[model samples]
Target: MARFLITVVPALGHINPTMPIAEELKRRGHDIAYASGSDMQQYIENQGFRFFTAGFPSFKHYTSYALRKMFEYQGLVSNAFFFKVLIEYNRKLIVDLPPVIQAYKPDVLLVDCITHGGAQLAEVLNLPWATSHPIPGLIPSRDATPFTSWGLPPSQNPAVRACYRIIRLGQGLFYRMFDPAFNSIRASLNLPPLRHCVVTNTLSPYLILIPTCEGFEYARSDWPPQAHLIGPAPWGKVSAQDDECAWIDALPHDRQIIYVTLGTVQVFRSLDFYKTVIAALRDEGYFVVMSIGPVLDKKELEPVPEGFRIEPFVPHAKILPRCAAVIHHGGQGIAQDCIYHGLPSLVVPISQDLYEIATRCVSAGVSLKIPYPRLTPQRLRDALRKVLTDQSIRAATNSLQARFRATNAGATGATLLEQLARTKQPVYRPGSAS
Candidate 1:
């Protein structure tokens, strides 16, 4: 059996999608070892894959502040904090990885596109690596024109091109800063730098996945052959716990339901924003269920007005199917889930690359983006109403949804990885095979 090393960041959004693939690989008789931090150990092991953790600074301390600061500090530091923590806390990670590389001696490596550690490790080991991006931004390609650069729309207007130029400059600065470090890591192991294809989360060619469909995408292009769009990879649904909240049970069935969540990372930080959305949705007399995620105290959010409900977490995969629309933080995971269900979205993007994804969704017409820092009840109401009542949005989303269904991400990804396993040249194990 071919052994494969799959590495990821421990964030649930990245790790969760990786789970099914890991399971599929193990089931195919490949020895799969996952490398990440402690956060996803249980979930990874639960899927029956061997877990290897490269410890990072305890985000346990930040869990309390996590939800509270959902949109705070859009600075470069905040954007790259997880990576900073991964490097600083796990000083030995660079040094410690080689032995595991030697032990497993994987035939190929699969890494989350945004994860620097995994990418560097693959480079060091000289492994043929493929990137599993939760979104479509990892690969820098031009064939996906217009939407190719950071998924932003291409324009001839001086201001827009200027903005794109600035963004590109920033992106270049960020990548160049690490080029030396990554090159050093590769040199240490006498391995060449990594050059691999980006396997995006969506089923679109231009190195971007169009989770929503053709109608939703404003700027379309023919994508690269190396870039595969596998549609939204929705994980299997698990039944909700018997002890669901009373308010959740009491929601009216007459009005179409709208599921609103800031997702786990921003739920606590955006409590006021969530409350405002609840107030607006209730005022509009719509059935609304809000997942506050785990970082907040629902009790403190007490006197939660009538016609609204709150929970620490909800099975979005289960709930999205039942909802008329979804209002979310525009996380790639949530956006994909919304697209998978063909449900329209009002993307309240907070920070970092979220604005880019949200912008793409808005440009595509399947979703509308309301800037997080500027969110208000009226804007929220207007955006939600547009997503819910706009027939064109619904029709376009439905069409995209059909295409998404036809594009079975799980099977497609499995088939590709399996093919890579078979065709890749076997690495010599010296005397070990005897």
Candidate 2:
């Protein structure tokens, strides 16, 4: 049995997808250990994996800084500050990983794509590592628009293609902001400067495991040979206590259920959005089940509307199957859950790869994307109505659900990691090719 070490940023979105893979590995008689923030220690240990705190600040600190800066700053300044903080966070993880590796002596390292430090450390140590993308692959390609371009719809129109090219050029300029600090960190680790953009450079050329399938994603021919398209590896908690989920059972059975969440990161800034949703659906004959995330107090949303139920958290695995539709921040985890459960979605993407995923969902015909800036109560209500009544969206969701279910992503990921452990081959030498 091979020993595996999984490292991720502290966020639930990054950590959750790894659970199913880790469980499958353990089931196959492999030992698994997780290195992350201290806040996740209980959650990791609860899954029966050994947990090692990666010596980073609590999740609260990271989220607080992100939330404050995301609202406080604007344009290039906000973007620069976000990357600078992210790089510094990754630096801490890089410093903390050696000791964890020495203690765990893992045969292979599974690093989250966002955790650049872990990815770099894996290379520095010459360990077999596989980069795990909980979201869509960010690798640049000619087959599709750059991920940063909000994943604009692919087309044969020359004008559109030219615009995409211009966007790519602009994206390259934006990436240069991080070049000094990114290269400086690599230099400190005795690694060469990165040739690819920062996002793609973090990928392991040996294996890039994405928890999505071709049916739900844009076709891409330019992906590296090492890239693997495994289906959604979904993992979630379901409370055993009936009382914990009794609220779900009590919802009015006459109305269709709509599951709403802005995801953990965006939830802090979503109060206004939530209020708007509540107002939109106040008498729309739909039952809305909204998860506000634990960071926000439910009391903040005073005078809760009728036909709605709000909670700090709810198990999507248990509730999504019964829902008629999903309205969310286009987070990969929740987006995959919607696909897995065959639910059409209204996606309001705020930041990061969300816009990309939202774009893909729209292209796939299983969702409607409403850019956050354009999201008004009427727009949200209209989008939700379309998702619910559109037969094409339902059919597309059904098609993709079949595809997602056909592939056992957890098993596929486990098998690949095991193979890498056995073969001990490094597919791409770091910095050899951009």
- Candidate models: Cα lDDT each: 0.62, 0.80
**Model 1: which ten-residue window has the lowest total lDDT?**
197-206
Q: Tens-digit lDDT track for model 1 on 199-305?
A: 12212211222222333333334334544556667776343342353344555768888898876556435678777886677678777788876567888777877
lDDT of 2 by residue, 1-434 (tens): 99999998887788888888899999999999999988778767866789988846454567546546754444455556667666877779878889999999999999998788888888899998998987555677775766663546768788888888887777778877688888888999998888543776578877888888887777876667677788888886443432477677667777899989987667546788888888888889888899997577888787888778898777787788779999998888898889998999999887656777888888888899988878888888888888889999999999988999898888988888888999987543233443
Model 2 shows how many backbone clashes?
Answer: 0
Clashing pairs in 2: none
List ranges where model 2 is wrong by over 4 Å. Answer: 55-59, 63-67, 71-79, 149-151, 236-243, 426-434
The number of clashing residue pairs in each candidate reads 8, 0
Best by lDDT: 2
- Model 1 has a clash total of 8
